[model samples]
Target: MEKLFKQVAIVVDQDDALVKNLENLVSLTREWQSSFHLIYVVERPAFSFKNIWKGYANGRTQPFDTAEHRLKEYQEKLKKLLPEGTRIHCYCKEGKPLWLIRNYIHENQIDLLLLLQSGSRFKRQPIRFSQLVGKINCPMIMVPLHKKDYDFKNIVLPISHELPLKKIMIASFLAGKKNDARIHLLALQEQDAKRQRTENPYLFKTYQLIRDNTTLTVECHPVDGDNLAAPTLEYARKVNADLILVKPGSETSPPGIFHRLLSKFNFSSSGIPVMTI
Candidate 1:
């Protein structure tokens, strides 16, 4: 059978903590046996004659070369963690990260992208994982820097009428692979009374789809909240869920300082790996 994620790409960074988490990710996805590609982009600064001359004069290693070295190190570490004979390739480039990564995904037909969420902050400086949310063609998994180990035993799938049911299948596929895994369908309660009544059919249909399609144990519960992310994450925490299956279009609070502070409470900061599928 064809694998769910046949071609997987991981965005490599210099964060030591995230690099440590690679072992956990590799171990978790061993079933898929997918080809893993590691990509590291060196953010290039504006050209300056003095900088170039200094590098040439001092024989300092170029930024691209440095990126290649780091990525090779990552490749070696992953090689040790991954099963023998698994395909691994490394790409080191100097350019705008967002552009390069998107292009790479398209050009290489990456089925899934794994990115590292740096140290306790949802919005990291210089590189924000959220920026690539809807931009990439394929789904991406955001693994928290502090997340050392995990199992797909308890997978959280927050369902709402507004969101697509595609994630249901993805959740089921993952949960079905592991021993004794369960999928929690957290229905987002609509604040408006009229909309709440109208949305029940969609919720029930989602529940039925999971029941008919997969044998994994399933649970459904109503979650109350206007901001979709907060309640979903809160429930995951309450249940001690192992993984959360989120979407690229998952709701977020308005852009402001208050929202920034609240974002810290989201799944990325909780050291839980969230798959934005």
Candidate 2:
């Protein structure tokens, strides 16, 4: 089947590892037959010493010579890595990384945004990217630069009763385009298996939907866990999943035990990448 996303925008940074990771992601997208765009947001220095003294200074403001130079070097590297005749574009913006990326997605009509799992500058506080989850309309894929494994053969798609199944299905289809990839539609049943077998009709409905639409191998499993993250992570490990697709729920709500558990399961720490839909 043809790729669902015609255009994929990758947000680049100064980190070499991140650039390499983005290149791999773009390669996968191209294998699925999608166009790629590379963007590097050149942030203007906060305040130059010369600009601080001058009143209403324009020329005194710092020039993006450093940023432009770095961007050019990365562009060359990316061009060499990508296949010949691949369409690639770069943009340099002076603003916050998250906002610039979000705006780029909107203005360019991008179908998907590929970003390094954690920003180059903010590694300790990686959850900051989670803020953009609700803000952006298009789905974002976070790739861990430190990991060498790229094969996404086994995938876990966590399903809850909250979000629309259509959205999850669409995202899953885009990520797992190949027929051989295994997708597990996991649902954590707070109750026992016997009770859940009789109670939850949505589980069966989701299973039928996947079976009817896609050729990929699909399985449904009911887990026993009071906290959603525990069962999800356990199953992911058991299946040796390469990716975990989850829907970001309300952040303002109090952090339940499940939410806390998820916070601990850092994408950087886990060899598998987590894609929050």
Top model by lDDT, which number? 1
Q: Give Cα distance to truth, residue 264, candidate 1, Å.
A: 7.1
* lDDT digits (tens) for residues 55-124 of candidate 1: 4454332467766888889899889988899999888887788999999999999999987776544323
Query: Candidate 1: which pairs clash?
Result: none
Q: Ten-residue segment with the worst summed lDDT in candidate 2?
A: 54-63
In model 2, pairs of residues that clash are none
Off by over 4 Å in 1: 47-62, 119-126, 177-179, 191-199, 250-261
lDDT of each: 0.72, 0.62
Identify the runs in model 2 with alpha carbons over 4 angstroms from their true place: 20-23, 43-63, 118-128, 162-179, 190-199, 250-265
